[model samples]
Structures are given as C-alpha cells and as structure tokens.
Target chain A: MSFSHVAIIGLGLLGGSIGLAVRAELPGTKTTGYDADPDVRARARERGLADTVLDDPAEAVRGADLVILCVPVGAMGEAARAIEPGLSADTVISDVGSSKRSITDALVAALPNHQIIPAHPVAGTENSGPDAGFATLFHQRWCIVTPPAGADAEKVASLVDFWESLGALVETMDAEHHDLVLAVTSHIPHLIAYTIVGTASDLEDVTRSEVIKYSAGGFRDFTRIAASDPTMWRDVFLNNKDAVLEMLDRFLTDLALMREAIRAGDGEMMHDTFSRTRAIRRSIVALGQDDPRPDFGRADHE
Target chain B: MSFSHVAIIGLGLLGGSIGLAVRAELPGTKTTGYDADPDVRARARERGLADTVLDDPAEAVRGADLVILCVPVGAMGEAARAIEPGLSADTVISDVGSSKRSITDALVAALPNHQIIPAHPVAGTENSGPDAGFATLFHQRWCIVTPPAGADAEKVASLVDFWESLGALVETMDAEHHDLVLAVTSHIPHLIAYTIVGTASDLEDVTRSEVIKYSAGGFRDFTRIAASDPTMWRDVFLNNKDAVLEMLDRFLTDLALMREAIRAGDGEMMHDTFSRTRAIRRSIVALGQDDPRPDFGRADHE
Candidate 1:
C-alpha cells in the first residue's frame, strides 16, 4: 500500500492476475504494464489490468519502485533488458517463471543495478493471455522467492509482503533447490502429461474420438495439463533440462519396475504402489491445494 | 415408478450412489440392498441407501423385479450364483462392474435362468464404501450396457430407461466392443496413472515428499487416478488383459518416440506433440468432459 507505483511486464495471465491481486489487496499502487503484443496491452487497458499501458518496457517501469516480469523463461532476458533503463536503483525486480535458476541468472545478467529478487508463484491455470487473469488466482498458493545472496533484505521482505497481501505463503530458497524441487513437483509431471496426451492424440481416428468421449476416467486430467501454454512449457523443459532429465530418469526407472510387475502379474506390487500414492492424494487434499469437493465445471458438466 | 421393487447387491460407492440416485429420480420404486460386509450393509440401511437392507443377497433379490449387482468383477459370478435361486424368473439382472465381458460371461454361466443385461455405469471415485455414495454421482454420466446377442429387446429398452431416469446416457454396445472401447478409454489410462504415481512414490524420501508437497502443477491429477479402488482396478487390468495390453503397447510406443525426441533435444517435436494434444483437450472440453476455461480449478473472474 505504501508503494506509489509498480510495473508488470508481459501482461499475460500471471502479470494481469498479479495486477488484479495488487489492485484488490495492495490498494492505490498505480500499476503499469508492458507486453510486446499490442493486443494484450489494449485488452489490459479495456479491462483496467493496469493504470498505465505503454509500448516501451522502459516507459512502463520508469517511475515504479517494484517491477515484476511475468513472461516465458525464454523471454525473461529480453524483457529484463528492455525495462532496465527505466527501473530505479531501489526497485526490487522479480519474475514468475517456472524454472528459478535460469530466470534468476538471466535477470542478474540483464539488470545489474536493480535488486533482483526472483519469485515463482506456484499457482496458475492452463490458460494464458491477459484475459485469463483473476483476483483469487494467488489465494492460498505458494510463492517461492530466490533472492540473490546477501541482497537487500528489506526489499525482499517488501516483495514478500506484497505477495502475502495477495494471500500467498512466501518461501525463500536458493535457485538450484527451487529448480530441483520443481523438477519433481512440476516439470517432470508436466512432461509426462504432455507425452501421455500426445500419445492419445496420435491414436487412430475412431479410437481418438472414443478417447475424447470417455476421457473422464483419467486421461482427461492429462489433457488439461498438456493444454497449458505451449511456449512457456517448451521453454521450461529445455531450460531446466538437467533437473528435468534427472527426474525423468528416476520416473522411467520406476515405470520400468511397474511394467515388470504388471508383466509378472504381481498384484501385490501394483496394490502397494497404488496405496502409497493414495497417501499423497490425501496429503494434498489435507493441505487444501485441491478441493475435496467435486466440481464438474458447468461448461463441462452440462 | 411402475416397477414394484428393485434390488442392489454390494452397497459400496456404486450401489449406494445408485440407490440414492434411484430414490431421488425414480419415485415410489421400492429398493433393497445387500452387502457382504455387514458394516456397509448397516451403513447403507442407516443412510437409507435402499428401502430394505438384507444380509443375504438371495433375500434381497427375492421379490425384486430388477436385481443390479454393483460388486467387483472377480466376485460377480459368485454373487450372481448366490442370489440366482431366489431371483424371480422374469427379473432383469445387471451389474455395475468395470469389465463387462468377463462379468457378463460369468453371470450367464452362473444364473442361466435370469435375463442378465450386463451393464457398467462408467462413473467412479477413489473412495469406496457406502459413506462415499451420494445422489448425484451418476448424474449426466455414461452407463454402458453390454447386452447379449439375442436378449429381450423390451427388457433392454426398460433397463436403458432405468439408467436414463438416473441421469445417465446409456450406450448399448456388444460385450467385446465395450471391452475394447473401455480398454482405451479407461483401463489403459488407469494403468499409466498407477505406473507413473507408483514411480514417483519410489523416489528418494526428499524428492518423494517434495512431489506430494507441490503436486498442483500436474502430478496431483495422476494421484487421484492412481488412488482409485485398487482391487477393482486390479481386477480390470487382469480380466481385460489382452485389450489393456494392446492399448498399453501403443501407449509405450508413443512414449518411446517422445523419449527419443526429448533425448535428442528436439524442441520442434516436443512442441508439435504438445500442440496436437491441446486440440484433444479442446475436444474434451467441448464434449463436456472437463473445464476448458483456465484449468487447475480456477473459477471465472466474473
């Protein structure tokens, strides 16, 4: 609430949603937005995604003390440099990228003068673009901040406070740890989803339609995950290849073991594996990350 | 409403939910239920899952015009045999088992006198037992009826009417076609989910905990599928082995191709695969299988 201005780069789901949350919860902090897509900027203006929409990133960040980049990992460096000239020396710059280390590295390289406090709000939808934002997107979600070592503690604290006001639980971890953790939690899982859905998409015409028709069983879940923004996910897998590959290796090895068990008709092994994963579902439900209540979205339910 | 009495055996989620749905939609049709587990039978009675609760399956089916067995596939034959002696000669019997061919064949062998219309209401949850049942579980879901080649057309039509009244779209396919269709739509997908989640569960403790902690990205979706009723799913894979194996073979072939692409760092291939699958998600969303608008359960901005 104390900050007079904030700059949001990219103006997509993350940026626009942050603008909405900041407006709803941060109060009177004039938000500015920048995106290469002129249509997104126009939509932002119509929807009041930000108080000011500008063509140049520098102009958007010119007077703001806080600048947030909410673009794909592949675009972070360019966005960072474009806004660097307008960012104040006291500005705390952050990003909502899936891979922490790559974006943090890029930010450090692109804007040396600004306080680069990398953040990843571990909450989002498969949808993208400015129109895909909402105020409650960050509520009860995890926000991981990987601050540059021994950097401005107060600036980092302020940014964390801002996220908290948006109802996110702030966590601070090193960039490598963040990437490794997300590899298991998000990256590898996303890759598998993309692959599985990809597998189904290649099915014969008749089978493919049947797959879509009766997908409610389980494949529907993978389809939702695979439908995420293609460019963002493509960059995530490429940028975090090592961590992704490591996690993928472990996953493949485990899958091989499962395949063997199934081949051998080892019901005990299958049952045990299923039972163990059920505990994970219980934990997630307990943590309230997933709604225990059933939701057949009216669009889908109808 | 015209049917004097209906009976459901095995009052788990399927039977109990069926009973509740019938009670809500089919006025004045007396229903009775039987469960092998007395505790479940008592819960079904207390919760008014049926108009009557009987310990003996035969006693429950004695006077009912319709006897629906909502039991595991492995037990369907035995259950059919147990209640056959008391079932009315004109009574139409059905079962809500996942695999139709195996159960239907068994029912024919066990209860030669009864007009068995093997049916499977293709809706479910990870939770089992009577307490997990609710009135709306089958609302707007599919119920596949694998009627025998020369079965009574009127009986089939009435059975279809019964499910339609309970808010299901009834699709009557032959047993073999139903098995093949379900192998692609349900069984193979479940196997992959179980395999992937099983793999994650076998990871090192640190990564394992991290997987559970941050499952919102994608893995949590698989967790729900993997957490399904293990015994029922196990029986499904076992009974529908040939069909499941064929689908699994195709899935593995596709997955291997993806693995090669990832290994070669072919961004174009990965992107192509992902982009194609997004269309399937769109179809599923369009077909009312899942929420297409900003997945991961984010409500509309409004």
Candidate 2:
C-alpha cells in the first residue's frame, strides 16, 4: 500500500481504469500514466486518472515501484522496448495484454534483470481510450497470471493481491496453457463474430440497409462483437494463430454437420443440438456470468 | 377503451402478455384466455392474465369481440381450425405468431367467415409460458400487421390503436414481404446462432467445458441467441424456407470468402472486412435499434 508510485502505460480504458481503481480502491497510492498520444495523456491528467500523466513511458515509469502495461497486444513489444531504458531492477512489471507468450518474451528481452509477471484481466467493453475508463471495470472478472517458474514469488503474490483488491478472481497458469484455453474461449468466437458481421456488410446496399434496420434479432449481437477494437482482436488472432487455427478447424467441422442437418431437414438433430446448448446458458447463469436479470431487456415480465 | 370480451388463445408468453398488456393499457377490457393444458389455463386466470381461462379454445372465443391466436407458428393452423367454430362472425381475429405468411394462409382458409388480421409483435425474451406474462413487453418495439387487402379498415384501425397503446410502433405490409423481411432479419440469424452453438456443443469435453467457462468473450452472445425457443425457431425456418434460404445463400458466400481468407492468411482482407462491419454497428446505434451502451450486456452505463 505504501508503494511510492505505480506507472500505467497507455492511457486507454484498461490503463486509465487501472489508474482510477488503484487511486480509489488503494488510496494513498501514487499513480502516473503514459501514452503515445499526448491528447490522451492530457485527458488522463484532466480526468484525474492518475496523479501524473506524461508523454514518455520512461518519464512515467522512472523510480516507480510497479509498472503496468495496458496497450494492445501488438504494441506490447514496442511498449516494453520503450520502457526498458528507465525500469529499475526491482520494479514489478506486469501487463494486461490478451496474449501472454509473445508479451512475456518481449518484456524479458527488454528488461533482462527486472521482475516481470505477465497477466491478463479478462474484463473489457468494446469502447476504447481514456474517457471510457471506469473505477470498477475489473470487478468480479477473472485475471490470469502466467508467470514463469523461478520468477520473483513476492512480486507475483503482490500482483495477485493487487488484482484481487480490484475484485478480480486471480488465477495462475503457464503462457502456453493460457493461449490454448483462450483460443477456444475467446479468439475463435471473436473471429466467427467478425466473419458473420463482415458477411452481412458485403450484401447489396438495400439488403445491408435492411440488415442494419432489423438487426435487433441476432445480427446485432454479431455487430457488437464485431465492433470490438479491431487492432486488438487482429493482434490476438495473429499472436495466437496456432491455437486459433486449431479451434477454427474444430468449429468448421461441427458447423458443417449442422449445415447438413438443416439442409436435410433433420429437425431432431437441430432440436437436440439447440437443447444441449441451453445447458451451458444455465451454467453461465449459475456461475453468475450473466446479467442475472431473468428478462434482460424485457423487464416488464417481472 | 372498453373491450367487453377479449379472448387470447395458446396461453404462452405472447398470449398471456396480450391479456396482461391489454388489461393494464386498455381499461375495462374483460380478458379471457385458453390453453390445451388445463394447469396453464388455471394459472393464467389465477395470475390475472385473464379474467377467465378455459381449457377449450372454442369456449374462450365465445362472446369475444377479439380472438388472438398465440400458438407456435407450426400449430397455428390446427388452433385456427379448432377455434373457427366458436369465433363470432364480427370478431377481429389476429395472431401473435412470428412467421406471417403461413399463419395468414391458415387463417384465410380456416376462418374465412371471420375478420382475421395477422399481427406479429416483434418483441419477446427467451422465457415463455403463462407465468412469463408481462404488462409492458411491447413498449418501444414494433408490431407488424399483415392484413389482407380490403379487410375491414375499422377492425385494422382498432387493432392498431390497441397495439399502439401497448407501446408498439405499428406498421402494415403484405404477409409475403413480412416473411421475407423477417427471414433476413430474424429467422436466418436464429438458425446461424443455433448452428454455431450446436457446433460448440459438439466439441470435445475439454474444449466444450472451456467454451462455457470463457463464453464471456463472444461465443456466449451466440449461446444466448441459440437459447431462444427451439419450437418457434424450427417452425420459423420451415415456414419461411425461401427467404431464409436466400439469406443463407448470401451468408454462406460471405462466410466462404472469409474462410478462404483465413486459410490463405489474407490479413488485409480480414482487416478490411472487420473495418467495414463497424459502420453497420454505427448505423444500428443511429437507428436506435441498439442502446449505445458500449457493451450490449443490458447494463446501464453512465
């Protein structure tokens, strides 16, 4: 709690919110934020996202006790390279990037002797930038840490405690396992959403217009998923290509079977499949992953 | 708005909700409801979904000024045939089914002597049955009317007024066009969601478990979609096969292009498609089809 300073790299929602959460949740914690965009830096300072906002990563991290990277996955390497020059030997460096293996490698090479603990907080909205940050973005969400064996145990413990204080359920695993699990869980799903929405976008102008108009059905869901930060998702697919491609292969195989069922007018097959998927929703509700409101949008039902 | 007698057939969410909405919105309306299941009718009356509930659909339609058929699309014909005998010659008969083409056709044949105006309220949640009745589910949603040309204008006008009072934006079109529009809008989208969730459900145990656990990423959205009423969706596909197939053709072509792009590692194609889809989302927000909440999780964001 007495840490002299916590530096947040990239004044996007994740970084800005972490700064805000640390400020409010861990009062007396001195915070500084850095971003390549000077406008974002100014906004962060104006919004009191941090006690200090600076253009240079080194300026933000200099003499800081902890440095947290919260940039797009593709930017992690460059961010680490830029911050390495000023990172102290004992600074606990962590990240909220989606990919773990690639980021951990970049940080290790950038700051050879510094204590680095790669982490990913599985909480976010499609929105981006400093102004979108909130004080409780990570509340009740999961945060996974992929620390290499023999890494500084005290730093790992402190990082876990930090996320826990922000209402995150902290878990630890290796980089490869994290990538594989997330491939099925997140990457492939996002890609499919992007693919479907992209499909609808390519329709004739009239058809596309109607699609947007009547999107309240199911296409709107895909659009919401498709609207996620493209650069971040692009990097996710590229960085996690192996796991993504594997998951996609399985998905395609299953989708092919479903297409066949529909083509053959196999109601039994369709009904059974639809029914099985319903159980996962029940489990999701049980796990408190859903809104818990029975009729989410149709509150009149109550 | 004193409706002396209002009869709602089928006793599901739509039927029960019609009773609920009308009772609350149009005062002094004596509502009656009927379902094949005696227990459902008993509960409907007990819960005040209707002032009177009957097991026989014909009995419920007796002495009623309005008779609403609220059964699943596939069952509409049978319900129409069964209740035709009891429908008064001057009764304004309508339906709350999803697909309009088939329902309108069934009503034309089965209730030729009665005034039938097919209606579909474009609002509902995953939950169903009498217990799921709500007084305001139609608020701010659309209620599309597919009245046969030269049908009694007074009856249509009265129905429109009733729906408007229930908070629906009423629009009228031919049943064919309605089917086509909803095919692209709702039916095909539901089919795709069911297919994708089916695909996920077929994954190996490890991947399947991971899918449910990490569904928050994007797949969960599809699951919520796929979790919709299977009977209703199945009938929608069968009833609106032509339009659904047309939309499916377009979607499949688009998906094939995307599949090839991913297979060939066409990064530019992926990036361009993703960027294009984002505009549709902006349009949906502009149309107020979506709540501009950064995330579509039904949460009120500040």
| lDDT leader | 1
lDDT (tens digit, per residue) of candidate 1 on B1-302: 34568899999888998899889999778999999999998889899999899988889998899899988888898999889878888999988988888988899999887798999877776678888788877776778888998898898988998999888878888888778778777787788778767666666634665666666766777777777788887778767777777777777777677667767777788887777878988898787766656664533233
lDDT per residue, candidate 2, B1-302, as tens digits?
33467888888888888888888888877888889888887788788888888778888889999888898888888988888778877888899988888888888888778888999987776677788768877876678898997788888988888789888878888888778777766776677777767666666634665566666666667777777777777777767767777767776677677667666767677778777778888898887666676666444222
Compared with the true structure, model 2 gives a TM-score of: 0.92
Model 2, A135-202: lDDT tens digits are 87877667889998779887788888888987777889899878877776677767877876776666
- What's model 2's lDDT at A156? 88
Task: Give candidate 1's TM-score.
Answer: 0.94
Q: Is the docking of candidate 2 incorrect, acceptable, medium or high quality?
A: medium
Q: What are the per-model DockQ values?
A: 0.53, 0.49
In model 1 chain A, the worst 10-residue window by lDDT is: A293-302
Report the number of backbone clashes for model 2: 0
Candidate 2 ranges with C-alpha deviation above 4 Å: A1-4, A205-209, A295-302, B1-4, B205-209, B297-302
TM-score of each: 0.94, 0.92
Interface RMSD measured for model 2: 2.7
- Candidate 1: docking tier: medium
Clashing pairs in 2: none
